[model samples]
Target: MENYLNALLTDVMLKEEEIGDICDKACEILLNEPNMVNVPSPVLICGDIHGQYYDLLTIFKINGTPKSRKYIFLGDYVDRGANGLECFCLLLVYKIMYPSNIFLIRGNHESKDLTKIYGFYDEVAKKYGNSRVWRYCCDVFECLINACLVNGRIFCVHGGLSPSLLDIDEINRIYRLNKLPDNHFVNDLMWSDPDELNPGFSKNSRGAGYTFGSEVTKKFLEINNLTMLVRSHQLAFTGYQMHFKEKCAVTVWSAPNYCYRCGNLASVLRVDENDITGKNFLIFKDTPQKPSSVGLPGYFL
Candidate 1:
């Protein structure tokens, strides 16, 4: 498996069977985890890989290996970029290799509907000439953890909170058996965004989930006895965006130069303790082009 991972690390494509096996193994590890995974501090929190395999590698290169530092990915691993397949596979391999050290939660793009419309579905079909690989990955997506708690002080999710949510236990109670994870409560957890100006919940322009306000974040943290809420579902051209009063929530985007043309920076958050109020942002720009094998098919570009 290490050899295969090493090959993949260098842009070597895996056989279709190898990809299937990876998805299967990732699912096995993910199933045992609760919807709200608990993690220790002194870890790195990343957000919105959105494919961009080369940039993914650059982030890893800068952050060091998962063998030493723990990581929490806020999802959106696929879609909109050139190498969603490779990005997804590499992440699954990491999860399989170090189940406890690396944490992952599902984003809105993990849904079947979104993938079918986005580039991931097409990337799988283009590579394998079938949807089998996509299906395999979708199953693994279903098994991803939905939220994370860092030493009980930081709440990590792919998106903002659902108005109905009062605590992490509520997220765990959600039934985990959906290709889209569109159930009302979970939908907000995966698609909602935080608005610093708004005082409460409002209809999100994204057509799903609400735009949560500072008060909402404040109240949620107060109710949960948490000090910070870390999430990622939007672009922060400077790499990261902070929100809410008391600097309680932050959005960390790891996809530098998003879509290979946004000219935006990216970042990952480093938490050194349970408090998580420490502002440690590791910012970076995009890297060079991907291997021709995983480069855009022109249309996606």
Candidate 2:
């Protein structure tokens, strides 16, 4: 697997039967992916890599990996930094070596009680002393893919607008079994947030979803004919954040100096296959040293 992903990019740690055969082949490729997933335009979306594994290897060393482009990953790969299980088993070994160019959704700390109160369940029971590889990576994060849409007119998600989501086939008829749920619509598409001076919903002070606005993101992109709404749970010193006027939403945040003391600044959002309103916004920072085989102790929610 590319020398086990280059020995987990140099801080090796993957032999609990190879993370249970990479969580049984990434839960059989996230169970035939559904709960909303379409992806097309010259991809590369990314956001929140809370595990900061070398800033996820400096986002493939400034956007150019996964064999030369194509990604999605709006999710929080895992709790706090210090290689959250090697940044989620090197993104499930690049989604089992590029399953149609890798995509993954489910954020809000990929639950199971927020990785046992953040820190990926004690960094997987302190590096596999047990927890059966964190219960096969929480059954592959309950078969991920909660939202994504790209070429049909962008709408990826990690969180934001979800009053039972009115369309996108109601996010492909939800029902993402096990863990994650303290409120509906798959915990508001993984914990909503986006109130640029409230023009609609409210509540979320992290007390569980709902903060939405901008006319509820322009009425959920005019009832799903969509135009834009990419997401990533809060925190944007300059990494990313745009709302209502930027035509509804955008929040990418590839985790720069976030919990390492929120000096924030990190992003990603390439798009532009045939000009899906052509986009770009690489930005980066953080990584001035913090890898002497990281000794753990970083936290964020």
Candidate 3:
């Protein structure tokens, strides 16, 4: 496992069979987790990677690797960038190797519906010469946990609050057996965004979920007795954005220079052990240049 991780970090490509084995192992691990997972604090919370493999590597460089620090990735691991397969595979490798230290939640882009339109599908098909690896990955995506509770106080998810979610129990009861659905609580959990302009729920421009306001966020936090809601779905020029007057909700974007053109910074939220109020925001910029192919495959370019 260490060898595989090193190879990926250095821009080396794994064989097709290796990817299949890794996906199989990841699926087995994810199947055992419930819809709402409980993770501990002293864990680093990160948002979307979107196939930016080099930037993902930079994240590790700035915040340490998963082996050294606990992490909860809020999803959108694939699609958009040039190396989605490598980015996703590296994360899966970490999850398989350190199941207890790492937690992953589903994002809207994890769905088969979105990947087909985005860049993930073509990247995999082009690299592997078949759809077998892509299919296996989709299977694993179905089992990804939707939300995580850190020390039973902080709520972590890919997107913001949902209208149908009154409590964390409702999140655990969701049946995420297929691709994300429109107009469904599961979809909202992974697709919704927080709105500061509106005072209540309003239709999202994305046409899938609602944009909740500060009142809605406050109500959700109070009802759940949660200190804060940490999520990632929207981009922040400064890498993270804090909403609600009390800093009850935050959006952390980990993909710097999103889509290789947004010129946006990225950040990760580090919560110390037994200190829910101590959120250390670590900011990072994109790599000066993309990593060289080196031992990578010919198709990497």
lDDT of 1 by residue, 181-254 (tens): 44477888999999888889998999999899888888888988888889999999999988865788899999
Model 1 ranges off by over 4 Å: 178-183, 291-301
lDDT, residue 219, candidate 1: 89
The sequence of per-residue lDDT tens digits that candidate 3 reaches over residues 178-276 is 544567788888889988788688888998888999898888888988888899988899999988677788999999999889999999888998867
CA lDDT, candidate 3, residue 301: 52
Instruction: Name the candidate that leads on TM-score.
Output: 1
Cα RMSD to the true fold for all candidates: 2.6, 17.1, 1.9
Ranking by TM-score: 1, 3, 2
User: Model 1: what TM-score?
Assistant: 0.94
- The better candidate by lDDT, 2 or 3, is 3
Better of 1 and 2 by lDDT: 1
Q: Model 1: how far is 52 from its true place, Å?
A: 0.8
In candidate 2 the C-alpha lDDT for residue 111 amounts to 76
Least accurate stretch of 10 residues (summed lDDT) in model 2? 292-301
Candidate 3 residue 189 C-alpha distance from true site, Å: 0.6
lDDT of 2: 0.80
Candidate 2 residue runs with Cα over 4 Å from true position? 1-12, 15-20, 23-25, 37-85, 90-103, 106-167, 170-220, 224-228, 232-237, 244-247, 257-301
What's the lDDT for residue 194 in model 2?
85
